[model samples]
Target: MAKQSIAEIRKKEILSTFYEVAKVEGLENTSFAKIAQKLEIQPSLIVHYFKNRDELILALIQYNLDQYKQIFSIAHADDLSHQEHLNKVLDKLFSLDWNELYDDGVYYSCYTLIFRHPEIKGKFKDLHLELRSGLKTILEQCTKAGFLAIEDPATVAHQVYNLLDGTYYFVSMLDVKADQEKYLQQSKTLAKKLIGLH
Candidate 1:
Protein backbone atom coordinates (compact mmCIF):
# COMPACT_ATOMS: atom_id res chain seq x y z
CA MET A 1 0.00 0.00 0.00
CA ALA A 2 2.83 2.39 0.81
CA LYS A 3 4.48 1.69 -2.53
CA GLN A 4 1.21 2.23 -4.34
CA SER A 5 0.66 5.52 -2.54
CA ILE A 6 4.13 6.73 -3.47
CA ALA A 7 3.50 5.83 -7.09
CA GLU A 8 0.29 7.75 -7.06
CA ILE A 9 2.03 10.79 -5.59
CA ARG A 10 4.75 10.57 -8.22
CA LYS A 11 2.12 10.37 -10.93
CA LYS A 12 0.46 13.51 -9.61
CA GLU A 13 3.83 15.28 -9.45
CA ILE A 14 4.55 14.33 -13.03
CA LEU A 15 1.18 15.62 -14.11
CA SER A 16 1.80 18.92 -12.34
CA THR A 17 5.15 19.32 -14.05
CA PHE A 18 3.53 18.54 -17.36
CA TYR A 19 0.85 21.17 -16.78
CA GLU A 20 3.33 23.92 -15.92
CA VAL A 21 5.59 23.15 -18.85
CA ALA A 22 2.70 22.76 -21.24
CA LYS A 23 1.26 26.10 -20.20
CA VAL A 24 4.54 27.90 -20.85
CA GLU A 25 5.82 25.94 -23.86
CA GLY A 26 2.56 24.62 -25.36
CA LEU A 27 1.53 21.00 -25.80
CA GLU A 28 3.77 20.40 -28.81
CA ASN A 29 6.74 21.37 -26.70
CA THR A 30 5.84 18.98 -23.91
CA SER A 31 8.13 15.97 -24.02
CA PHE A 32 8.91 13.25 -21.56
CA ALA A 33 12.48 14.46 -21.33
CA LYS A 34 11.32 17.99 -20.54
CA ILE A 35 9.01 16.78 -17.82
CA ALA A 36 11.67 14.47 -16.46
CA GLN A 37 14.12 17.34 -16.35
CA LYS A 38 11.59 19.52 -14.55
CA LEU A 39 10.94 16.79 -12.00
CA GLU A 40 14.61 15.82 -11.78
CA ILE A 41 13.83 12.24 -12.63
CA GLN A 42 14.40 9.83 -15.49
CA PRO A 43 12.20 10.23 -18.54
CA SER A 44 11.29 6.61 -18.11
CA LEU A 45 9.70 7.59 -14.83
CA ILE A 46 6.93 9.30 -16.75
CA VAL A 47 6.70 6.33 -19.06
CA HIS A 48 6.18 4.14 -16.04
CA TYR A 49 2.98 6.00 -15.22
CA PHE A 50 1.93 6.90 -18.75
CA LYS A 51 2.60 4.36 -21.45
CA ASN A 52 3.21 6.99 -24.13
CA ARG A 53 2.93 10.65 -25.01
CA ASP A 54 -0.68 10.17 -26.03
CA GLU A 55 -1.43 8.64 -22.67
CA LEU A 56 0.13 11.60 -20.94
CA ILE A 57 -1.95 13.94 -23.03
CA LEU A 58 -5.09 12.08 -22.09
CA ALA A 59 -4.21 12.33 -18.42
CA LEU A 60 -3.72 16.07 -18.80
CA ILE A 61 -7.12 16.33 -20.41
CA GLN A 62 -8.63 14.53 -17.44
CA TYR A 63 -6.81 16.90 -15.12
CA ASN A 64 -8.36 19.88 -16.87
CA LEU A 65 -11.83 18.41 -16.59
CA ASP A 66 -11.24 17.69 -12.93
CA GLN A 67 -10.44 21.34 -12.35
CA TYR A 68 -13.79 22.36 -13.78
CA LYS A 69 -15.50 19.72 -11.71
CA GLN A 70 -13.98 21.22 -8.62
CA ILE A 71 -15.38 24.58 -9.64
CA PHE A 72 -18.83 23.07 -9.90
CA SER A 73 -18.43 21.56 -6.46
CA ILE A 74 -18.30 25.00 -4.89
CA ALA A 75 -21.31 26.17 -6.87
CA HIS A 76 -24.60 26.49 -5.01
CA ALA A 77 -26.73 23.61 -6.14
CA ASP A 78 -29.43 24.47 -3.61
CA ASP A 79 -29.59 28.15 -4.44
CA LEU A 80 -33.04 29.74 -4.36
CA SER A 81 -33.73 28.78 -7.98
CA HIS A 82 -32.19 27.28 -11.10
CA GLN A 83 -31.16 30.73 -12.28
CA GLU A 84 -29.22 31.13 -9.04
CA HIS A 85 -27.35 27.90 -9.69
CA LEU A 86 -26.57 29.08 -13.21
CA ASN A 87 -25.40 32.37 -11.77
CA LYS A 88 -23.08 30.59 -9.35
CA VAL A 89 -21.49 28.56 -12.13
CA LEU A 90 -20.94 31.66 -14.21
CA ASP A 91 -19.52 33.54 -11.25
CA LYS A 92 -17.12 30.69 -10.55
CA LEU A 93 -16.04 30.59 -14.18
CA PHE A 94 -15.55 34.30 -14.79
CA SER A 95 -15.63 36.25 -11.55
CA LEU A 96 -13.81 34.10 -9.02
CA ASP A 97 -10.09 34.63 -9.31
CA TRP A 98 -8.67 31.25 -10.12
CA ASN A 99 -5.06 30.44 -9.46
CA GLU A 100 -2.52 31.27 -12.16
CA LEU A 101 -1.39 27.67 -11.99
CA TYR A 102 -4.80 26.72 -13.43
CA ASP A 103 -5.99 29.94 -14.93
CA ASP A 104 -8.27 30.56 -17.90
CA GLY A 105 -5.26 30.32 -20.19
CA VAL A 106 -4.59 26.79 -18.99
CA TYR A 107 -8.13 25.71 -19.86
CA TYR A 108 -7.89 27.45 -23.24
CA SER A 109 -4.67 25.62 -23.99
CA CYS A 110 -6.11 22.24 -23.05
CA TYR A 111 -9.28 22.88 -25.04
CA THR A 112 -7.29 24.08 -28.03
CA LEU A 113 -5.20 20.93 -28.00
CA ILE A 114 -8.27 18.75 -27.71
CA PHE A 115 -9.92 20.29 -30.78
CA ARG A 116 -6.86 20.83 -32.95
CA HIS A 117 -5.15 17.51 -32.35
CA PRO A 118 -6.91 14.42 -33.63
CA GLU A 119 -4.68 11.93 -31.89
CA ILE A 120 -6.54 12.20 -28.57
CA LYS A 121 -9.94 13.15 -29.92
CA GLY A 122 -11.65 9.99 -28.75
CA LYS A 123 -10.48 10.40 -25.16
CA PHE A 124 -11.53 14.03 -24.97
CA LYS A 125 -14.95 13.57 -26.52
CA ASP A 126 -16.50 11.80 -23.54
CA LEU A 127 -15.12 14.35 -21.12
CA HIS A 128 -16.51 17.17 -23.21
CA LEU A 129 -19.93 15.50 -23.32
CA GLU A 130 -19.92 15.05 -19.56
CA LEU A 131 -19.07 18.73 -19.09
CA ARG A 132 -21.92 19.72 -21.38
CA SER A 133 -24.36 17.57 -19.46
CA GLY A 134 -23.18 19.07 -16.18
CA LEU A 135 -23.84 22.56 -17.53
CA LYS A 136 -27.22 21.53 -18.86
CA THR A 137 -28.19 20.15 -15.48
CA ILE A 138 -27.72 23.57 -13.94
CA LEU A 139 -29.88 25.14 -16.62
CA GLU A 140 -32.57 22.50 -16.24
CA GLN A 141 -32.68 23.20 -12.54
CA CYS A 142 -33.25 26.88 -13.32
CA THR A 143 -36.07 26.08 -15.72
CA LYS A 144 -37.66 23.91 -13.09
CA ALA A 145 -37.85 26.93 -10.78
CA GLY A 146 -39.25 29.24 -13.49
CA PHE A 147 -36.04 31.24 -13.64
CA LEU A 148 -35.76 30.48 -17.36
CA ALA A 149 -38.17 29.76 -20.17
CA ILE A 150 -39.34 26.16 -20.46
CA GLU A 151 -37.55 25.71 -23.73
CA ASP A 152 -34.76 23.15 -24.15
CA PRO A 153 -32.38 23.69 -21.25
CA ALA A 154 -29.66 21.61 -22.87
CA THR A 155 -29.57 23.86 -25.94
CA VAL A 156 -29.55 26.99 -23.83
CA ALA A 157 -26.73 25.57 -21.72
CA HIS A 158 -24.71 25.00 -24.87
CA GLN A 159 -25.19 28.65 -25.83
CA VAL A 160 -24.05 29.79 -22.39
CA TYR A 161 -21.05 27.48 -22.69
CA ASN A 162 -20.15 29.05 -26.02
CA LEU A 163 -20.26 32.45 -24.40
CA LEU A 164 -17.88 31.29 -21.66
CA ASP A 165 -15.59 29.65 -24.21
CA GLY A 166 -15.46 32.78 -26.33
CA THR A 167 -14.69 34.94 -23.34
CA TYR A 168 -11.87 32.64 -22.26
CA TYR A 169 -10.44 32.74 -25.79
CA PHE A 170 -10.51 36.51 -25.80
CA VAL A 171 -8.94 36.69 -22.37
CA SER A 172 -6.16 34.32 -23.42
CA MET A 173 -5.25 36.25 -26.59
CA LEU A 174 -5.95 39.91 -25.97
CA ASP A 175 -3.50 42.10 -24.07
CA VAL A 176 -6.11 44.60 -23.04
CA LYS A 177 -5.62 46.04 -19.55
CA ALA A 178 -9.34 46.09 -18.84
CA ASP A 179 -10.53 44.94 -15.45
CA GLN A 180 -11.57 41.28 -15.27
CA GLU A 181 -14.23 42.19 -12.75
CA LYS A 182 -15.96 44.51 -15.18
CA TYR A 183 -15.76 41.95 -17.93
CA LEU A 184 -17.21 39.32 -15.60
CA GLN A 185 -20.07 41.65 -14.68
CA GLN A 186 -20.88 42.10 -18.34
CA SER A 187 -20.71 38.34 -18.77
CA LYS A 188 -23.22 37.79 -15.97
CA THR A 189 -25.52 40.40 -17.48
CA LEU A 190 -25.40 38.75 -20.86
CA ALA A 191 -25.84 35.30 -19.36
CA LYS A 192 -28.96 36.38 -17.46
CA LYS A 193 -30.40 38.05 -20.51
CA LEU A 194 -29.71 35.05 -22.71
CA ILE A 195 -31.35 32.70 -20.20
CA GLY A 196 -34.30 35.11 -20.01
CA LEU A 197 -33.76 35.48 -16.28
CA HIS A 198 -35.01 39.12 -16.40
Candidate 2:
Protein backbone atom coordinates (compact mmCIF):
# COMPACT_ATOMS: atom_id res chain seq x y z
CA MET A 1 0.00 0.00 0.00
CA ALA A 2 2.77 2.45 0.87
CA LYS A 3 4.59 1.73 -2.42
CA GLN A 4 1.37 2.17 -4.36
CA SER A 5 0.70 5.47 -2.56
CA ILE A 6 4.14 6.80 -3.51
CA ALA A 7 3.62 5.72 -7.12
CA GLU A 8 0.31 7.57 -7.18
CA ILE A 9 1.95 10.69 -5.76
CA ARG A 10 4.71 10.54 -8.34
CA LYS A 11 2.15 10.07 -11.11
CA LYS A 12 0.22 13.13 -9.94
CA GLU A 13 3.40 15.22 -9.78
CA ILE A 14 4.44 14.15 -13.26
CA LEU A 15 0.99 14.90 -14.70
CA SER A 16 0.95 18.35 -13.07
CA THR A 17 4.36 19.16 -14.51
CA PHE A 18 3.15 18.08 -17.94
CA TYR A 19 0.05 20.26 -17.62
CA GLU A 20 2.03 23.44 -16.83
CA VAL A 21 4.56 22.84 -19.57
CA ALA A 22 1.87 21.96 -22.12
CA LYS A 23 -0.08 25.13 -21.37
CA VAL A 24 3.01 27.35 -21.66
CA GLU A 25 4.67 25.70 -24.67
CA GLY A 26 1.48 24.66 -26.48
CA LEU A 27 0.49 21.00 -26.29
CA GLU A 28 1.76 20.23 -29.78
CA ASN A 29 5.20 21.56 -28.84
CA THR A 30 5.35 19.77 -25.50
CA SER A 31 7.44 16.62 -25.17
CA PHE A 32 8.16 14.13 -22.42
CA ALA A 33 11.69 15.52 -22.14
CA LYS A 34 10.29 19.00 -21.49
CA ILE A 35 8.03 17.72 -18.70
CA ALA A 36 10.92 15.76 -17.22
CA GLN A 37 13.19 18.83 -17.38
CA LYS A 38 10.50 20.94 -15.74
CA LEU A 39 10.27 18.44 -12.90
CA GLU A 40 14.02 17.75 -12.99
CA ILE A 41 13.37 14.02 -13.32
CA GLN A 42 14.41 11.40 -15.84
CA PRO A 43 12.28 11.41 -19.00
CA SER A 44 12.20 7.65 -18.71
CA LEU A 45 10.24 8.09 -15.46
CA ILE A 46 7.29 9.51 -17.39
CA VAL A 47 7.56 6.93 -20.15
CA HIS A 48 7.61 4.19 -17.55
CA TYR A 49 4.13 5.24 -16.43
CA PHE A 50 2.71 6.49 -19.74
CA LYS A 51 4.06 4.82 -22.87
CA ASN A 52 3.74 7.85 -25.17
CA ARG A 53 2.34 11.33 -25.70
CA ASP A 54 -1.23 10.29 -26.37
CA GLU A 55 -1.25 8.07 -23.30
CA LEU A 56 0.08 10.90 -21.16
CA ILE A 57 -2.54 13.26 -22.55
CA LEU A 58 -5.29 10.80 -21.74
CA ALA A 59 -3.93 10.33 -18.22
CA LEU A 60 -3.79 14.07 -17.68
CA ILE A 61 -7.36 14.43 -18.87
CA GLN A 62 -8.49 11.83 -16.36
CA TYR A 63 -6.44 13.52 -13.64
CA ASN A 64 -7.99 16.91 -14.40
CA LEU A 65 -11.48 15.47 -14.42
CA ASP A 66 -10.76 13.89 -11.03
CA GLN A 67 -9.65 17.24 -9.66
CA TYR A 68 -12.83 18.83 -11.01
CA LYS A 69 -14.82 16.20 -9.15
CA GLN A 70 -13.39 17.59 -5.92
CA ILE A 71 -15.26 20.86 -6.47
CA PHE A 72 -18.62 19.18 -6.06
CA SER A 73 -17.58 17.92 -2.64
CA ILE A 74 -17.87 21.49 -1.36
CA ALA A 75 -21.60 21.44 -2.07
CA HIS A 76 -22.38 19.31 1.06
CA ALA A 77 -25.81 17.96 0.20
CA ASP A 78 -27.43 18.54 3.57
CA ASP A 79 -30.20 20.66 5.06
CA LEU A 80 -28.69 23.96 3.97
CA SER A 81 -30.86 26.58 2.31
CA HIS A 82 -30.99 26.79 -1.48
CA GLN A 83 -29.21 30.12 -1.47
CA GLU A 84 -26.57 28.92 0.95
CA HIS A 85 -26.07 25.67 -0.91
CA LEU A 86 -25.85 27.43 -4.24
CA ASN A 87 -23.49 30.01 -2.82
CA LYS A 88 -20.95 27.33 -1.98
CA VAL A 89 -21.26 25.94 -5.48
CA LEU A 90 -20.99 29.35 -7.16
CA ASP A 91 -18.04 30.50 -5.09
CA LYS A 92 -15.85 27.71 -6.44
CA LEU A 93 -17.34 27.97 -9.92
CA PHE A 94 -16.53 31.67 -10.24
CA SER A 95 -14.10 33.60 -8.11
CA LEU A 96 -12.64 37.04 -8.77
CA ASP A 97 -9.01 35.91 -8.53
CA TRP A 98 -9.55 32.51 -10.12
CA ASN A 99 -6.69 31.34 -12.30
CA GLU A 100 -6.22 27.64 -11.73
CA LEU A 101 -9.75 26.31 -12.00
CA TYR A 102 -10.43 27.33 -15.58
CA ASP A 103 -7.14 26.04 -17.02
CA ASP A 104 -8.07 27.72 -20.28
CA GLY A 105 -5.17 26.76 -22.50
CA VAL A 106 -4.73 23.23 -21.25
CA TYR A 107 -8.48 22.51 -21.30
CA TYR A 108 -9.12 23.93 -24.77
CA SER A 109 -6.11 22.16 -26.20
CA CYS A 110 -7.29 18.80 -24.85
CA TYR A 111 -10.82 19.47 -26.18
CA THR A 112 -9.44 19.83 -29.70
CA LEU A 113 -8.12 16.28 -29.49
CA ILE A 114 -11.65 14.83 -29.50
CA PHE A 115 -12.00 15.86 -33.14
CA ARG A 116 -8.55 14.73 -34.19
CA HIS A 117 -8.35 11.60 -32.03
CA PRO A 118 -12.01 10.46 -31.98
CA GLU A 119 -11.40 7.79 -29.33
CA ILE A 120 -11.05 10.50 -26.65
CA LYS A 121 -14.51 11.90 -27.36
CA GLY A 122 -16.33 9.66 -24.94
CA LYS A 123 -14.21 10.83 -22.02
CA PHE A 124 -15.24 14.46 -22.54
CA LYS A 125 -18.82 13.53 -23.31
CA ASP A 126 -19.10 11.66 -20.01
CA LEU A 127 -17.49 14.50 -18.09
CA HIS A 128 -19.88 17.13 -19.44
CA LEU A 129 -22.86 14.89 -18.74
CA GLU A 130 -21.63 14.42 -15.19
CA LEU A 131 -21.33 18.18 -14.70
CA ARG A 132 -24.76 18.82 -16.26
CA SER A 133 -26.46 16.26 -14.05
CA GLY A 134 -24.79 17.59 -10.91
CA LEU A 135 -25.86 21.16 -11.64
CA LYS A 136 -29.34 20.05 -12.60
CA THR A 137 -29.68 18.25 -9.27
CA ILE A 138 -28.74 21.38 -7.36
CA LEU A 139 -31.03 23.48 -9.53
CA GLU A 140 -33.86 21.07 -8.85
CA GLN A 141 -33.27 21.53 -5.16
CA CYS A 142 -33.38 25.30 -5.57
CA THR A 143 -36.64 25.03 -7.49
CA LYS A 144 -38.13 22.86 -4.76
CA ALA A 145 -37.03 25.37 -2.12
CA GLY A 146 -38.93 28.08 -4.04
CA PHE A 147 -35.87 30.29 -4.43
CA LEU A 148 -35.44 29.63 -8.19
CA ALA A 149 -38.19 29.28 -10.77
CA ILE A 150 -36.16 27.50 -13.44
CA GLU A 151 -38.30 24.98 -15.34
CA ASP A 152 -35.48 23.26 -17.23
CA PRO A 153 -32.56 22.74 -14.94
CA ALA A 154 -30.69 20.75 -17.61
CA THR A 155 -30.74 23.59 -20.12
CA VAL A 156 -29.88 26.16 -17.48
CA ALA A 157 -26.95 24.02 -16.39
CA HIS A 158 -25.57 23.87 -19.96
CA GLN A 159 -26.00 27.65 -20.28
CA VAL A 160 -24.14 28.20 -17.02
CA TYR A 161 -21.27 25.92 -18.13
CA ASN A 162 -21.01 27.77 -21.45
CA LEU A 163 -21.04 31.11 -19.64
CA LEU A 164 -18.16 30.02 -17.45
CA ASP A 165 -16.21 28.54 -20.38
CA GLY A 166 -16.63 31.61 -22.57
CA THR A 167 -15.72 33.98 -19.77
CA TYR A 168 -12.61 31.98 -18.97
CA TYR A 169 -11.53 32.06 -22.61
CA PHE A 170 -11.98 35.83 -22.87
CA VAL A 171 -10.26 36.57 -19.57
CA SER A 172 -7.27 34.41 -20.42
CA MET A 173 -6.68 35.98 -23.84
CA LEU A 174 -7.55 39.66 -23.26
CA ASP A 175 -5.32 42.09 -21.41
CA VAL A 176 -8.24 43.88 -19.77
CA LYS A 177 -7.40 45.06 -16.27
CA ALA A 178 -9.73 43.96 -13.46
CA ASP A 179 -11.62 41.86 -15.98
CA GLN A 180 -11.82 38.85 -13.71
CA GLU A 181 -14.14 40.53 -11.29
CA LYS A 182 -16.30 41.86 -14.08
CA TYR A 183 -16.61 38.45 -15.69
CA LEU A 184 -17.48 36.79 -12.39
CA GLN A 185 -20.07 39.42 -11.53
CA GLN A 186 -21.58 39.12 -14.98
CA SER A 187 -21.89 35.36 -14.47
CA LYS A 188 -23.44 35.74 -11.02
CA THR A 189 -25.94 38.30 -12.24
CA LEU A 190 -26.87 36.28 -15.26
CA ALA A 191 -27.26 33.17 -13.12
CA LYS A 192 -29.70 34.97 -10.90
CA LYS A 193 -31.66 36.07 -13.95
CA LEU A 194 -31.62 32.60 -15.49
CA ILE A 195 -32.91 30.98 -12.31
CA GLY A 196 -35.50 33.76 -11.91
CA LEU A 197 -34.19 34.54 -8.45
CA HIS A 198 -33.83 38.23 -9.08
Quick one: best TM-score, which candidate? 2
129-184 in candidate 1: lDDT tens per residue? 77778878877776776666658877877777687766655565545546555666
Candidate 2 TM-score, true structure as reference: 0.82
How many clashes in each structure?
1, 0
| Number of colliding residue pairs in model 2 | 0
Regions of candidate 2 where Cα sits further than 4 Å from its true position? 1-4, 73-79, 97-99
> What is the overall TM-score of model 1 with all chains considered together?
0.80
For model 2, which pairs clash? none
Q: Name the regions of candidate 1 deviating beyond 4 angstroms.
A: 1-4, 75-83, 96-119, 177-180
